[model samples]
Each structure stands twice: as structure tokens, then as C-alpha cells.
Target: MELITNPQPLQWPTLLKRPIFDNAEIQQRVMPILQEVAKRGDEAIRHYTQLFDKVTLNAFQVSEEEMAEAQRLVPETLQQAIAQAKRNIELFHTAQYDAEKQIETMPDVICWRKSVGIEKVGLYIPGGTAPLFSTVLMLGVPAQIAGCQEIILCTPADQYGKVNPAILFTAHLVGIQKIYKIGGAQAIAAMAYGTATIPKVHKIFGPGNQYVTAAKQLVSQTGTAIDMPAGPSEVLIIADHTANAKFVAADLLSQAEHGTDSQVILLTTHAPLANAVNAEIARQLETLPRKSIAEKALENSKIIVLPDTETAMAMSNVYAPEHLILAVEDPDALGEKVINAGSVFLGHYTPESAGDYASGTNHTLPTNGYAKAYSGVSLDSFVRKITFQHISKQGLKNIGLTISTMAEAEQLRAHAAAVYVRLEE
Candidate 1:
């Protein structure tokens, strides 16, 4: 990670100015693949899966037998971990299951809102270098809580036309049966367009790479709702002299190992601590299994030594990191001042991975600086709020004039006429 000291207060444009793709590259590279998928369907899926993943499959579905065998093959210790995570996830999200609220807007104008689950939602689980079975709980528990029916899942199978046994095992743990062994742009296309086997859904959720992010953008353009403008993982750590360099380095490397495109940043008040962190990052990264991928991400990471905590916090708010870890003396106080973030990890004992895996918080979050507007997935993401009104005689008498008067001012004569007609009736 490059260390920059005595920096100017940065703006969003300046923060985003770090060289990534411009729209031109995105349009040029991703448009054709999306177009092809839109036209060809499953054949396109087969073609791309073979080309990119180097896997050919006779069929795409993970059979019932395979799911059972996956369960059997998984290590017992990991299964116990998954079970514990599931319980906590269920406990938190289950509370988010709320009943419809009815409010009397006026004496006669009774207004209320009810949430209904978005039927046939699609979930994409990344199954490459890391078998992220924990993501299953983060997604599945909320979908279940929101009472979503027909939750379909897709992930890229390995070269052997198979997925990690743990991934399959986690799926079963959450009561999902329909699993597709597909991934990338093609998988998003199948979920958005509907194939001979893969059913189309109204909304898709999960974090993925640039191609997958591009695919989701295309899906939304074609009239499908997505959870958020999710991209590869990113984190911002606001640390102080009190922070442990070893722990800070470990946290940075954890997110870095996610992918080559993942970003990590450390904004600290102390210069010596930053130097110590840089040294520890080198030592820790040398032993990581995904060191090369982490190295590319580290190249993009920034360690900025700010003169004060206020300046460091300002930089973090501008970035709106998906995961914000406060390695300070009083993280709870620091966290309170935070306006936006997907998830917050406080103090030395709290690591971002705890939230990522078993901490019961949704790991699917806004990326590419989208936390400024978008939110991480929750039970609410799976449901739509529908407003209802009941106009009894008293309600009509009280609210009719207000509605008609507003309508007439806008010159919506027909709207006023409809209310007038209601009055007459």
C-alpha cells in the first residue's frame, strides 16, 4: 500500500479519481456479451461458461443427490460453524419481519402500507478461491424472513462441473433447493431473462466482480431490480496511535485477498503507526494463500497519515466504505459520528471478517462509493411496500376537497372529476 502524508481534504471526485475503468471501457467490453445473452439464452450461457470458466456441463442444475452428498462431504467442524452463524442471522433478521401498519391520514381518509415479498428473487453466490458458504446465511435468512417464495440461486461450478460441498450444504441449511451451476455475466442474464431451466426473477442480490457488476447494470437497464450497485469488496480503516499494527495489517490483507480489484485504505492519525502497519502488511501478506490477488489489491490501497481524527473521519465519510473498521481508543464514539457505511466494526477485537461470515450482519453491501445513496441488503430489500387507502363517508368528506383542490391546481381535470364522481356516488 502507498503511503501519502500531509494530504489535502479530498472530495468524492478526487477519491474516485484513482485509476479504474472509465465508462468507455465498460461499454466497449460488456455490451456485446450482454446483447448476445439477451438474444441466445441457455446456449449463450453454455458458450461463455466454457470459455471463461473452462468448464463444460451436460446440465446446469445441482441435483438433490449432489446437495446431499455435498453435506456428507463437508467437514463436521465447518458445519457446526455454519449452524451457529445461521442461528444468529435468523435471530437478527427475523426481527425485521414486520406487520403492516395502518394510519388514519384523515377522519375519512384511512391510509396504510403493507410489505409484500418480491416473488422469485435470484441470489448469486461467488464460489471461486473462497467458498463463501457464509454468504448463504446472510442472504437466505432475510429472504426467508421476508417470506420470499421461489428463491433461486446461481454460482459458477468448478472445472469438474461441481461446486464446493460446503456451498451446497449451506443452501440446504437455509431451505433452498433449486441451485444452478452457472456464474458470471451469463448467470445474471439467465436470471434476468429466464432460460429453459433457470427461472427469471424480479431482483438479484450478491457481491461479485466487475463482469458480474456490469451484468447487473444490464439487468436493471432491461427492467429487472437489483439489490444495489454492488461491486468488489472495499474497506476503510480509521486508526490511531492506540491501534495495533499487526491487527490492522491482518484486516487490510483479509479484504485484499478477496480479489485483485478489491480496495483497502487506512487513514490514521499517527505516522509511526502507519509505518509499522506497512511493515506488518509485508510480513503477513507473505504467508497468505491468495497473496498474488491480495498484492494487486494492496497496490490500490492507500495509507494516509492525517494530522487529526476529524480529518481522518471526513475522508472515511467521503469514501463510504462497505466495511468501516475503527481501530481507535473509542470506536463506538467514532462509529456514532459516521453518517454512512454498510457495516461498522469497532475496536481492536472487532474484525471485518466477523461481520462477513458469522456476525449475523448482511455482507452484501454497496460498493464503488454507492453507500452515499444505496444500502446493504436486508429483509426490506426482498419486499415492496404497497400503500392502501380506504375512503369511508367521513374520510371522503375530510380528504376529498384537499385532493380535488390540488388536482385542479395542476390542471389534472380528470383527476378532480374522478373525486367529484366519487362524491356524487
Candidate 2:
């Protein structure tokens, strides 16, 4: 990892820039796939599946027999673990359900909001390099809890035209029936515009590579809703002398191993601690199976020595990392100032993996500094809040004059006429 000492505030933006590809080339590559899927439908989906995933499939849907086989293939212990994580996710998301409450804004004008589940939603689980079965739980549990009518899932199949057993197992666990063996930008397109087989969704959810992210952004521009602009994984660790060097190094490598585009950074107050963490990272890299991938990611990462933990925390807000780990002593104190992170892991013992797997929090979070604006997936992501209001005669009497004055001032005659006509009646 590159080392820097007390970088200027002006330099922070350049320092915190995420590893991204040339936007023009990425869009150029992605648009044709989306167009093909839009025009050719399932045939296009199959073509791209063969082209990108190197897998050919006569059928895209995972059958009940396949699901049963997957259930049997997955170890009982892992099944039990998935069940436990499902329960925790269900427990956390269930609490987010909104209760209807009527409020009187005026004398007799009553207003209330109701949460309605999006009729159809899509979930994309990444299957390359690593099969993110955990993502099925993260997105599926909430969709179930939110009572979304239909939850369609798309994941890439292997060369044998079979998905990872664990992914199928988790999908079954969460009661997701429509699982597609399609992946990447084509999958996003299928979900955005319904194909002969894959259903078009009101909103799409999940994390994927830059192509998938760009596809979501493109579809959203044309009025299809998406969860967030979540792309590659990233994590920021703020450590002090009191933080565990070994644990910090391991955490950094954990995210770095996600993909070649993944990023990890360490902000420390002590130079020795930074150096020690670097040394520990070197030692730990030897044991990681994805060391080659992690090594390339580390080329884009850095370890910076700040004047103090406060400065580090401030810098962290500017970066707005998808995952932020405060490994310093009394992380709670520093966390009070944290305003921009997607998810925060506090203290030495808490690892970001907990939330990614079984801890109650949602693993589908904002990335690419989007935490500055967008939010992670939750029960709310699957539902839309529609507000309702009723105005009684007394209510109109109380506010009619103000409404007429405003509408007339704005020269909207029809708007004022509607109110006046009602008052006259």
C-alpha cells in the first residue's frame, strides 16, 4: 500500500477516488448488451450468458428439482447457518415496517401514508470469482418481509449450466421462486424490460460489477427504479495506536480480495502503526487465496498517517466509504461525528464480515461515494410510501382564502377555480 503523511484537504478528493474504468468505454460496452436484451429478449439473454459467462443454457429458470438437489448438496451445517442468518435479517427488517397514523394538519384535513410493496422486484446476485449466496439473504429477506408480490432473482450459472448450490439454497430459504441463470448487464436489462421468460421489475436490487451498476443507472434514467448505484466493494479503516494492527491488516485484505477493482484504505494517527499495519498486511497476504487479486487492488489503496484520529474521522466523511471500520479506542466517541458512511463497524472486535453475513444489518449498501446521497437496501427498498389526505368542509373553510390568494398570485386560474367551485358548492 502507498504511504502518505498529512495530505492536504485539497488532496483528499484525489486520494479517495475509487478505482473506476473509463466511463465512455464501459457505457459503450454495456449499452449494446442492454439493447440486445431489450430487442431479442430471452434469446439475447442466452447469447450474452454464453458470451460472458461461457455457459450455454436451454432454459434460464432454476427448476424445483434443481432446487431440491441444491438443498441436498448444501451441507446441513451451512443450511442451519443460512437459516439463522435469515432469521436475523428477517428480525431486523421486519421492524422497519411503517404503521399507518392519521394526522390533522388543519382543522379537519386528515393525512396518512400507507406502505405498498412494489408489485415486482429483481435481485442480482454476483456469481463470478465468489458466489455471493449471502446477498440472496440480504435482498430476499427484506423483499419477503415487505410483501413484494414477485421477487425475481438472476445469477450466473457455471459452465455446467448450474448455479452455486448455496445461492439456490438461500433463495429457496427465503421463498424466492423465480431464479434465473442470467448474469451481468444483460440480467439488469432483462429485469428492467421483461423478456419472454424473465419478468420486468418495478425496481432492481443487489450489487455487481461496474457494468451492472451502469445498467441500473441507465434504466433508472428511463424510469425504472433501482435500489442504489452500488458497484464494486470498498472499506475504510480508521485506526490509532490502540487499534489492533493484525486485525486491521486482515480487514483491509478482506475487502481487497473481493475483486481487482475493490479498494481498501487505512487512516492512522501514528506513523509506526501505519508501518506496522503495512508489515502485517505483507505477512497476511501470503496466506490469502486471492492474493493476486488483492495485490492488484492494493495498488489502488493507501495507508495515510494523519495528525490525529479527529482528522482521520473528518477525512473519512469526505470519502463516505461503503463500509467504515473505526478500530480505534472508544470508537463510539469518534462515531458520533460520522455522518457519511453506508455502514459502520465500531471497535476492535467488530469485523465488517459480521454485517455482510449474519449480523442483523443489510449487506447491500451504497458504494462509489454514493453514501453521500443514496442509502443501502432495506425493507423500505421493496415498498413505496403513498400518502393520502382528506379535506372536510371545515378544513377547506379554514384554508380556502390562503389557497386562493397563492393560486391567484401564481396566475393559475384553474387551481384557484377548483377551490372556489368547491367552496361555492
Candidate 3:
């Protein structure tokens, strides 16, 4: 990692910029796939599956027999682990459920908001370099908690034309039965515009490669809702002398291993700790299976030596990382100043991996500086909050004049007359 010492605030933006890409080119490539899916439906899906995934499939949906075989294929220990993670996820997301409470904004006027789940939703699981079975729990638990009427899953099949066993097991665990053997931009298109076998969804959720991301963006333009704009995974760690160098190195490498485009940053008050962490990263990198991927990601990453914690934090807020780790002496105190970040890991013991896997928080988060505006997926992501209001005769009389007067001032005669008619009734 490159080491820079106390750079000027003006230079922070250049130093912190994420690796750039030609999104227009990716969208240009993805558009034809979407158009084909819309025009030809299942035939388009089959053609793309053969072209991209290199598999010819007779059927797209996973049958009961395939689900049973997948269950048996997953190790018993993994099943237990998945179950434990599911419970924790359920516990955290279930607590987010809000009971409807009516409020009297004025006398005899009652108003309240209720959460209604999107009737149909689709989840895409990437099965290229990594299977990301943990994501199944992240998305499925919340969708179930939100009471979505119909839930379907799409994952790319391997060269041998089989979905990941762990993915299927986890989906079955969450009560999702509609599993499809589809992948990439074609999967997004199938969900966005219904094929003969794959039903269209109200919203599409999950992270994928550049093509998949582009496909989601294209579909969203045509009226399908997507979770958020996402990119390569990233993490930022703010550490000082108090942080363990080995642990910090491991955390940084964890995200770095995600992909070549992934970036990790370190902001520190102590220069010695920065060196120590780099040394630890080099040592740990040798043992990792994805060391090549991590090494490439580290090329895009760096360690910055700041004058103090305040300056480090200010830089972090500007970067607005998808994952932020406060590895300082007083994490809680520093946490109060955090205005931007998709998810935060506080103190020495807490690691970003915990949230990615078993810990209750959803791992599907906003990336590429989007944390400034977007939030990580939660129960609310799966449900829409619909607000309702009721007004009695006396309540209309109390508020009618204010409404009519505002309408009249705006030259909206019909709006004023609607209030006047209610008043007369």
C-alpha cells in the first residue's frame, strides 16, 4: 500500500477517488441483452445462458428434487451454521418491525403509516469466483420478515450447469421455493421483464459484476425498482496505536480479496502502526487463497498518516466508505461524529466480516461513495411505507379554511372547491 503523510485537504479528493470505469460502455453492451429478453422472453434467456454461462439448460426453474439433492450435498455443520446465522438475522431484522400508531395531528384528525411488502421480489446471487451463500441469508431473512407475497432467486449455474449447494440450502431455509438457474445481465432482464418461466418482480436485489450492475440500471429505467446502485466491495479502516496491527491487516485483506477492483484504505494518527499493519498485511497475504486478487486490490488501496483523529475522520466522511471500521481507543465517542457510512464496525473486537456473515446486519450495502445518499439494505428496503389519513366533519372544519386559503393563493380553484364542497357537506 502507498504511504502518504499529512496531505493537504485539497488533495484528499484526488487521493480518495475510487477506480474509474467506462459505465457507458458497459450499459451499451447490456442494452441489447435486455432488448432480446423483452422481445423473445425465454428463448432469449436460453441463448444468453448458453453464450455467457456456457451451459445449455432444458429447464430454468430448480425442481423439488434438485432442492432435496442440494440440501443433502451441504455439510451438516454448514447447515447448522446457516441456521444460527438465520436466527440472528431474523432477530435483528424482526426488531425493525414497526407497529402502526395513529397520531392526532389535529382534533378529530388521525394519521398513520403502514409498511406493505412488495408483492414480488427477485434476488440475484453471483456464482462466478465466489458463491456468496451468506448473501442468501442477508436478503432472504429481511424479505420474509417484510412478508413479501412472492420471492424468487436467480443464480448463475457453474460450467457443469448446477447452482451452488449452499445457496440452494440457504434459500430453502428461508422458504423461497422459486429458484432459477440463470445468471449475469440476462438474470436481471428475466426478473425485470418476465420470461415464460421466470416471473417479473417489483424490485431486484443483490450485487454482481459490472455487466449485472449495468443490467439492473437499465431495467430500473424501464420502471423496475432496484435496491441501490452498487459497485465493487470496499472498506475503510481508521486505526491508531491502540489497534492491533495483525487484526487490522486481516480486516483490510478480507475486503481486498473480494475482487481486483476492490479497494481498502487506512487512516492513522501513528505512523508506526501504519507500517506495522502493512508488514502484517504482507505476511498474511502469503497464506490467502485469493492472494492475487487481494494483491491487485491493494495496488488501488493506500495508508494515509494523518495529523490527528479529527482530520482522519473528516477525510473518511468525505470518502463515505461502504464499510467503516473505527479501530480507535474510544470507538463510541468517534462514532457520534460519523455522518456518512453504510455500516460501521466499532472497537477492536468488531470486524466487518461479522456483519457480512452471521451478525444481524445486512451485508448488501451502497458502494462507490453512494453511502453519502444510500443506506444498506434492511427490512425497510423490502417494504414500502404507505401513509393514511382520516378526517372527521369537525376536523375538516378546523383545517378547511387553511387548505382553501392556500389553494386560492396558488390559483387552484378546483383544489379550493374540493375543500369547500366537503365543508358544505
What lDDT does the true structure give each of the candidates? 0.86, 0.93, 0.93
lDDT of 2 by residue, 224-327 (tens): 99999888899999998899889999999989999999999999997898888899999999999999999999999999999998999999999999999999
lDDT of 3 at 37: 96
Q: How accurate is candidate 3 locally (lDDT)?
A: 0.93
Clashes of 1: 3
Runs in model 2 lying further than 4 Å from the true structure = none
TM-scores, all candidates, are 0.96, 0.97, 0.97
Candidate 2: residue 199 Cα off by (Å): 1.0
Error of 1 at 205 (Å): 0.9
> Any residue pairs clashing in model 3, and if so which?
none
Clashing pairs in 1: 108-394, 108-395, 109-395
Supply the TM-score for candidate 3.
0.97
Ranking by lDDT: 3, 2, 1
- Deviation in angstroms for 180 in model 1? 0.6
- Candidate 2, residue 31: the lDDT equals 95
Candidate 3 residue 376 Cα shift, in angstroms, is: 0.5
Tens-digit per-residue lDDT, 188-285, candidate 3: 99999998899999999998878888899899999999998776899999998899999999999999999898989999999999889999999999
With a 3 Å backbone cut-off (N, CA, C), the pairs that clash in candidate 2 are none
Off by over 4 Å in 3: none
